[model samples]
Target: MAVAQKLQRCAVSQTGKHSASVIFLHGSGDTGQGLRAWVRDVLKQDLAFAHIRVIYPTAPPRPYTPMRGALSHVWFDRYKISADCSEHLESIDSMCTQLGTVMQEEVRAGVPKNRMIVGGFSMGGAMALHLACRYHPEVAGVFALSSFLNKDSVVYQAVQDRKGQPLPELFQCHGMADELVFHQWGEETGVQLRHAGMDASFRSIPGLNHQLSRMELEELRSWILKKLPLESSAQGQ
Candidate 1:
């Protein structure tokens, strides 16, 4: 299949000099504009994010199996979760290739691989996890919200073949009450990452659903701040 053009993106940047870039992908049926608003609201009150440039890329409209073949903005076609919780590997490689183009643009624009963070929600988060592990392994961190990994997928096999490379720091969160992506799957994703030698941390939000909660957002904020500090500080500088 031919590689798709870069997806339309919505962006936000701090006023001062930026030291890092964060690319966040939205879930199915959502646009980058929607994620931009959500991320802006989540980080607006915090000054620690003042030196980061945030990018939200819209996924292409395609047939989604979870929606019963309805066309929606999705990184890849998601089939039914198997009994072993492994996702179908079809289209994952192509999708990651497209996402890698976006990362390449960021690198060409002067941001180092180690100064970039990649993350997303739901299916978007699944893409982020795959990209970080297989394609952009040198990134600063990876965040997967209400998402899981397919250990049997091609990406996992590729990562397993690479030797002596450091894995990125990972912070994953899932709601105990999440009906869409079960909490157990998220826990398994964390275990897989750790077993692959990643510095992975998984957070479970009690009584929360698939949707974002204030407490979950706060926890994510803390994790991001801890992982990527303000550039104004000496340590960060």
Candidate 2:
């Protein structure tokens, strides 16, 4: 069975007219409410966010393999921290199925699949990449902050199956000084993704560690605005 949790919504659209949506997942051990509080502050700083509906979905506490089966709020379970390590496919697929439902709900709620973006931090970012690159290619874009993929990820195989078809745009940002998820892993993921015909861009943040920065968030905001601009009808209102 898929693990589930109540998602938290932050309606940034001040005019009550949303034209786009961003579903952002939080890192391992963090809850949706925690990330929503932080991102809400940064997003509100930009007027463009006023038309975007942000969804933060919490991962239910599960037995994390890396932590010796200790419970953690992670999108999936992995045997280790290395990007080259073996993947826990069962857990990963279950989470993807759950996220797919979330996307479908957004579509049913009036947001087109092409106007939605999936992104996250750390483990959450990895899940975002898995969903956008493998499961939900129809999303507008995907951004991974301080995250990476397994060296032999199923995402690569899924892309190969497309036979040169295009997937959603991808923006990956990593801290050069990150010790947990190395910058090299993020760069390699981007390179492999491009090799597989994905529209992927990677940004290297010098002197950054395993966390996010204001500059990184600003860059992400710019990318989001470019990917999902306000519709003509909404702009004229």
Candidate 3:
């Protein structure tokens, strides 16, 4: 028997068949219910996806072995990202397992792989993208907001492991004024994604800071609507 992953998540939905599900994986220090506020504030306006579900997965407050046993519920073990991200391969492997498990559960929640999207901020963004590389059962989209791939990694291994297939639609949104993670880093990773022949849209939000803004959330909602199930769109509208 496989040990079920220990994670906390908050799910929001109104009523409808729901075309797609947007899973927001929060950063290390945040809780799953955190994004719930964002959804209620922004997504609730549409009324289209009254049944659209947004699932937020929370990282625990435990010690992160990725940082040499440091105390933090991180997606993967940290290894001084700027220098080299490949060194943390082992930790990334563990993180991938938990992520895959979470994804599996979501699929069973009525949203199949193709009708799903994965996204997050900072550490959460990196992990969301990592899952995108290995996306199976298919995925509608991926978003990495104000974050970068492990320092200088093309993520070739994970890409190759996807049976020589390609990644799903992906968007890499950066904040020009983000001081936490250099805007250039996100740009570079976007380049890498494009180089890999994936449909990646890299947008740097001018005058924005580290956190995702209301306008950004609206953009996400719009993107989802354009691609979400037509039935869902009709119901939402």
Model 1 lDDT per residue over 1-237, tens place: 574777899777655567677888888788888876765576564323666777889988888887898998888886765426456566777788888888888889877888888999887888898898788888988898888776565545655666477677888889999885478878887887677567788999889888776676677767776766666552333
Q: All candidates' lDDT scores?
A: 0.77, 0.84, 0.70
**Could you give the C-alpha RMSD of every candidate to the true structure, in order shown?**
2.9, 2.3, 3.4
What candidate 2 gets wrong by more than 4 Å, as runs, is 1-14, 40-48
lDDT over C-alpha atoms for residue 126 of model 2? 91
Candidate 3: lDDT over CA atoms? Answer: 0.70
Give the alpha carbon lDDT tens digit for every residue of 1-237 in model 3: 457466778777646666567778877666777656654565555323654677788776656655666677676666565624454666666666777777787678766778788888877888887776764527888888888875556364555455456467777788899885568888887777676667779888999887777777778778876656556344645
Clashing pairs in 2: 13-50
Instruction: Give the lDDT of residue 225 in candidate 1.
Output: 67
- Shift in Å, residue 121, candidate 1: 0.8
Our model 2 lands, by Cα RMSD against the true structure, at: 2.3
Best model per TM-score: 2
lDDT comparison, 1 vs 3, better candidate: 1
